[model samples]
Target: MMALNSVARADSFTITGVNGTGVTASISNYSLVGNQFTFTITNTSVAPGSTGTITNLGFALPGNRANNFTLVSSTNSNYTIAHDLNATSGSQNFVSSFDLVLIDKPNGNPTFGGGSVKNGIAGGTSATFTIAGDFSGLTADQVAHAIFARFQAVNGDGSDVAGNGTSPVPEPMSMLLFGTGLAGVAARARRRRQGAKE
Candidate 1:
């Protein structure tokens, strides 16, 4: 349980279709700074050919871990945060599995859940959806925690992103090293002050 601060960490995971091409995807900006979280989604696949779905793509703000948060703001009125599918092109397929977990730091460990979406080839050329949610119950002390989303692609033959591994966590040694570095800097500063006095 780290102390909350003025900043919050955010991350993104892209679920590519079977063809490794783009799919129907959307993203919107949210009160990332105020609430200490933000996100974005980009469609890499062109239109009229490839397609896929991106689902279960969201993270929980560390502060609001107790009470689940939901995305209230969205670029599209019909857009929702839960399981979704995208198919605006051909046979291209984009989908995912697992849920999102936002922690306190780039290396800090946090909780996670299951989520996903399937992308297909239908609708228009491209579609975007941006959303924001209420994280009111979270304590102020947990604000600095980071945010991350677990992604996976299911079905359609061979290996898929659904089986993709989770984002790596920082090792204990790394934290120890960071602390040592900070201590060294403090010691040097103290020695310099003492030398100047003498």
Candidate 2:
């Protein structure tokens, strides 16, 4: 006999500005199923004459030990997000860099200095982007705890924001086991019906 359980969970959050730039960000429509995660992020400026750019975005997996995170999809008109690298050590962190450009600045406005810019995401106007990835490295006992995102503007203002969200739902192995159990039950039912017919 086998006991199988299936759980589905989803979560979302709004990111606060820590860089004194009056820029706000939000993550919505987040869902997790069997090690797959997806979410959307929207960035906007609250104050006038304020423009910014996103430099980096990352997610923190607390107990997971595997580093096989892969970006599945992304959609945004203003910015481009690309997978950067894993963290140094022991911190199951996945990072992605943003391609954004600043526009119409005074003489001393800050810039990326041609170091990390990629696809030219502009400020002042609102921009929204979505990202989906698979975290197959997580074990049955390990789960994701929190999500972190960081960004910077042309004025040298930046923020590293943390948001709370739903933890990893179920392990892939557990899902497989549950499927096998269901198949076994179906097979037994068919056999019983054939025996009675004979």
Candidate 2 wrong stretches, greater than 4 Å: 1-12, 76-145, 154-198
Question: What is candidate 2's CA lDDT for residue 157?
Answer: 46
Q: Give the TM-score of candidate 2.
A: 0.46
Q: Which ten residues in a row have the lowest lDDT in candidate 2?
A: 98-107
Predicted structure with the largest TM-score when compared to the true one: 2
RMSD of 1: 11.6
Candidate 2 local lDDT, residue 183: 100
Candidate 1 lDDT, tens digit per residue, 1-198?
554343322433433443343333333232244433344444433454443333334332333233333454433333344321232123322223212322112212221222223332122323333233444544222221222222223232212222112333443455777999999999999999999999
Q: Can you tell me which runs of candidate 1 are displaced by over 4 Å? A: 1-31, 47-50, 55-64, 82-198
All models, RMSD in angstroms: 11.6, 11.0
Clash pairs, model 2 backbone = 100-121, 101-121
